[model samples]
Target chain A: MRIAFGGNQAGFWWYMAAGAVLLLAFAGIGLFRGAVPIDEGDVLAVLARHLLPGERAADPSVDTIVWSLRAPRVVVAAMVGGCLALAGAQMQGLFRNPLASPGIVGTSTGAAAGAVFALTFGLAGTFLLAAPLFAVAGALLSLLIVTRIATRDGYTPVTTLLLAGVALNALLAAFNSWLIARSWEQYEAARRIAYWMMGGVTDRGWVHVGMVLPGMVIGCAIAVWFARDLDLLLEGEEVAASLGVDIEKTKRAVLWSAAILTGSAVAVSGVVGFVGLVVPHLVRLLLGPVHRRLLPAAFLTGAWFVVGADLLARTLVAPEEVFLGVVTAFVGAPFFLFLLVRHESEVAVSR
Target chain B: MMETRGSARRAPRLELVDGGVERRGRWLLRDVDLVIEPAMLTSVVGPNGAGKSTLLRLLSGTWRLTEGKALLGGFDLSALPRRQAARRVAYVPQTVRPTFEFTVREFVTLGRYPHESRLFGTRSADRGWIDRCLDDTDVLALAERRVTTLSGGELQRVLMARCLATEAEVLLLDEPTSNLDLAHGLDLLGLARRLACEGRSVVLVLHDLNAAARFADRVAVLDGGALIAEGPPAEVLNPDLLRRVFRVEAVPLEGSTAPVFDFEPLR
Candidate 1:
């Protein structure tokens, strides 16, 4: 029943190198193709003009599109994507259940509810600060409620976590629908809400990047800090505690970090489902399940996946952008089914 | 190395005084007074519903004693922070249902969490202890496999190795061999004997009387949540006592090799 592989060091290094290369390649591709569709040389030239003191020889419009508009969007995409992946990884570890994702656990829905509530009530001079604050509060509230219900007698059952998530998701979805239905004067408000729920990085600005970056940084740091404890927790709390882990403390910290990451990502870009769910699995496939390796790779791979998906969203059929979440679903849902089938076959074979 | 030695030198002594634990207004155990010395293998034996596990939980600080105070070392068990208490006593619950799959090495390394740095890496000494624990429990061969893929016996050994990696002075195991086969059960008992022989205090809740009689230095019997008997096997094992305790007739067969029990009564 034991598998001993002697090439672990080589395999691990290769995986890390591959992930870094993929991330860089994807970022490069994303920068080169945009509304103006600058070639790789042109993009590098523009970057050089900004960095070096040479004469700026590019079209001003091209410069604006490449530097101001698209650069910020890509950076925001990477930030939000990395946050979602890290949050997903932490939630999966904290709940000790593979199916435990931010969306399924109601973290994304709660954040979306907060954002919509703020927008509906016109709570800000602008949508700058009010939206993310409401989103964070909503995410924290949902996290507390879910953990309270899921944990009983110092144990949280996987079944209970999923069931609570389903119930909370339904309730929040209904509330969001009600808000949209009740507000008729905003006209395109319903459309905007619907599109946001599908998720995208279009029209993302420096303001969007600023709002989500801090949360992403803080959340990622906390997740990495507790990565070892999370590995133990994935085995079980008793095992973790016997291994000298403060199980309750590790659990609470992981839950908080997951909420922060999910809330901030949703606040900036809306409910991008399944990136948090799918990216980790994909990374686990490429690299093994050591959290030391899994956490960083999942972060970088998720950033690449989201940025690439956004690129496809924008350029798939000219200017009208497709929903980023829709594109992810197109890629993720089928892969999920494939994984389920593959896992079933493996289980069957083991039996 | 230095850390383990320091903790051992300053290790806490445990004392329970007229202590009992209650759940839902029902006393699981009551009016118990006992002192658990350091570095002793205290095996608790009882029938079903005897609250042996509850007493272990209370002593390990997982449950509160309702009547009198139980102190660990000098500090009250209730007053100690959970993390600090965890460093003192390691509790292995009877049933563990892991919801995710983790590798055996990752699982064992978790024992170093309390001694870990904030950056989430283990020291060289901690790593040595972890590997030594795996070697002690004979689970070194399983260091790479996912724990979910392990057999029940292998999983139990892995768990024991996790406890060993903590390097705590006191080890509390609840029904450690309850779900294992004959071979694994014997292996576990041998490991426990070795651990106790190494001067670490070990406490276990056991179902097999023969295993307890063979391996444990001292045996404590719990009935109705009270310590009914505490002594060596020769003093604790009697046909009358066995009848009163387990409702089963046990006839002692004298032999130089080892004492054998012919269990009968129900049939």
Candidate 2:
């Protein structure tokens, strides 16, 4: 395929280099902040003490605070962010529409519904990973329903799929609201569920990290494994099949991967919106759409976006931390509307 | 100005024995018995809804036959792996509107997917075969241009180039000229004729009777889901057969090697 957008002839290495620099820069900035007063060197020392053998920080209590408390929050934020964006890119490719995202596809909302179900129904008391595991089931279920409604004779039209997904998203959100309302009399449960639904990684520890990281990493690996087929699939399924692609097999594998990625992220962080939508679109603008490059770049950029968003969430209000989802929606919703408008006008022009 | 290179690598024999496909209790195509041989440009001519496109799909193995056997070189097409089937039969659809922007080079390179062994051999960029395909289709100059940016005629040539990259023995094209202007349509049909002359079977789903008659070595005429006439252009595309099957009268130009026909609907 030709280089998309033509203006950005800058190759993958340049994108990776620029992205890595910015990601590390934001992550460095993320490491230095918190309710506790920790500087850059202290942050580095805490990291060194954990990663390198026998290295010690000057202040042990500060080390305990940052390493045991603050570090996992930042790490989990990055992982969930990367997974959301990676899933978004795959969704976009699958539907052959840039508008396709985890949020749009109902995966995030479904997971949110499941997590809320766990929290209100008191399944969080059953096991440590109960809520997240339930969220995965919800995500997979919603995706299955939406695809079933949209697919006909092995062909899924973008318009029909989008309509189905949007409907499912609305339905799941209503279900979540019903859960919240039913448990409103339990003051503590309602507040906790509401806060969780707003999406954050505030007190997420290494355990939360362990829970989502493996599944997410494996999902990304599966995505990269089918990267070439993903690229050809952008040409549309019939064409891809003519080029020897196993259309149904490829679709099932990638959708399963996307669902897993979305579920893992939403399981931990509630319904964080649009990092998947915006990050992949931006990456494609810079590096073009060869999934081998697009997937990794989108992951890194998404990680950076959320890490930055989380940093802003904590420090932007200074002690009155904003919801992580609110911060992302503030930035992402406007961009999505712009894309939709552009899409509408393009359709008009084509007609 | 296209150079005709005839490296005919043992073109495969394609035969359809009573092939039929039904959908929703209706036979879109029934009993299509067509034998496609090497070094022949067979134009499948018919009125609208005559199942010309359906026949091409059956031959490409994109759509399966519900009734009879479809074979490529004596092996059942359904039994062959998708990649092996692709290696034997290449298909060019009527219109390709890819939403993603891929370069002409990349688009053509996709044809090499079937030849790539064991799935995941993108490391060795086979520029030789790709460039040769581009050169043959006369789009070497437009290699760097994005496919989305191409004009109708240029993109058609690019599609032909992509098909060439497959190195398949049989080429199935559906309404190749349906979207083109006069000159470009003739140019595309000429390219198809040259490929057939160089020893590969090329089948076309064509609507224009004169264009088909001009280039086809044989014309297979279909009406109401079955083959009505199949032979040399003069025999199959005569005014009487044309009037009966296509419901049109034609002033047949039969003096030249490549004939032309002017037709009007029989009211």
Candidate 3:
């Protein structure tokens, strides 16, 4: 069950170095691999010019492509990926289940329902921020309901939380489907809803980056601060409480932070799947389960995964972009199956 | 180490006065009056559903008494801050299955959580205590191994070491030897005795009557959520009480420090 990744200290640094290199490489691919070809040298020149003062740009068009169009999208993708993966890791630790993610607790579906509702009612068109705002609202509301239902005597049981999440997911997904069905008569509305449901990072600009960055930073910081407590909590609720962890408080804090992270990511990226579920599991498999290491490793790995997946989505079938979620699932589903098999055998051996 | 030895001068006297717990419209325990003094090993023994574990929970501050109050070191148990109370009392349950892989050292270091500052790293004093606990429980050799890879006996000792790492005056252990073999069980009990000898109060919930008689300085028998008897092992453990409370006949072997009882059904 325990996959030894070299030694603990040296392996951790090595993974960090490798992950940083991979992230930069993927970010480079994301920046330049589009319909309009931009040279890597040109991109670097523009970046240096922007950093320095009074430097003549090689080409304004290239600068625009790198800074105005591609940079924002790439940054947004990284932020959303890091946010969801960090949230997923926190959820797994909070529930003490490897399978737990933002989607498991209905947060993603709830946000989707909120966005769909906003779009169907024309609220999104009226207010530019309405869709993301409503999505965040829905995610937080669902988290509150789940927390309320799962809690008894100030303690939230994992079984009760999961059951509540399942029920809520069913109800929210049905509501989303109902909204889509009701708006089927309108072609434009139906198309928007359908495309949003498919999930993508295309055309996301600096505003989208701004919308999700604060939550990502705050949530990741909070998660890291509580990483030690999460390690103790994985043992069990009673053990954590006996070790002076305010169990109820810690659980509530972690759940809410996850909701924030998931809500913002879903708002910007439109319900991207598999990144949150697969990235954390992959990191834990490669590294060990210590949250101090797991959290940062998951964040970097998730950023790389989304950027790479987004690049493939844009380039695989030239000029016709594929949905980001579709590409991630195409790759992540088989890995998920492999993880399940490995997890099963690990459990068997441990038992 | 010197700090702990010096602070050991004031050993807390844990007392329960008319303490009772009710759950789901039923009383799990009531009118339980017991005093746990320092430097003593007290064993609570009864058949299933006798509220032995519930009493330990109450003492550990995990459960609230619906009536009356329990006091730890003269402060009401409910009034103490959770971290402060945790620093005073440590509780070890029957078994804990960790979902993540933590080394034995990492698992034992959790015991020092209450003593460390919230934002800072581990205190040097706390680290010393953790290492001492590992050495004391004879788990130093297993410190680097993953807890999941440990045997049941090794796991129990590791958990015991964790409890000791807290440096708490009182330990509430609920069936520490339940899944352990006879030799491991005796080793755990002997460790408990050693803890008591070092000015710590150890309250153990034991299902084995002979082990309780063998290791406990005091034995409290619970029947139907009430304390049926509380006294020294020789005073409380006897043929008549065993027959009355446990519905068994006790055949005591002679020439032992504490009588070893061989139970036969009442039929």
Winning model by TM-score:
3
Candidate rank order under TM-score? 3, 2, 1
lDDT of 3 by residue, A135-186 (tens): 8888989998988888887778878988999999999999999999999998
For each prediction in turn, the share of the native Cα contacts (below 8 Å between chains A and B) that it retains comes to 0.44, 0.44, 0.47
- The per-candidate count of clashes, in order, stands at 5, 6, 0
- The deviation in Å at residue A185 for candidate 2 is 1.0
Residue A236 local lDDT, model 1: 64
TM-score of each: 0.90, 0.94, 0.95
What CAPRI-style quality would you assign to candidate 3? medium
DockQ of each: 0.39, 0.51, 0.57
In candidate 2, the residue pairs with backbone N, CA or C atoms under 3 Å apart (3 or more residues apart, or in different chains) clash, namely: A1-B102, A1-B103, A1-B106, A1-B107, A2-B102, A2-B103
Q: Show where candidate 2 strays beyond 4 Å.
A: A1-10, A55-58, A145-164, A340-351, B4-7, B117-120, B123-125
Model 1 ranges off by over 4 Å:
A1-10, A51-58, A121-133, A144-165, A285-288, B1-12, B95-99, B256-260
Candidate 1: deviation at residue B133, Å?
A: 2.0
Q: lDDT tens string, model 2, A54-91?
A: 94646888887788778888889999999999999998
Q: Residue A18 lDDT in model 2?
A: 78
Q: By DockQ thresholds, what CAPRI class is model 2? A: medium
Number of the predicted model whose DockQ against the real structure is largest: 3
Q: In candidate 1, list every pair of residues with a backbone clash.
A: A243-B111, B12-B73, B13-B73, B39-B201, B40-B201
Candidate 3 residue pairs in clash (backbone atoms < 3 Å):
none
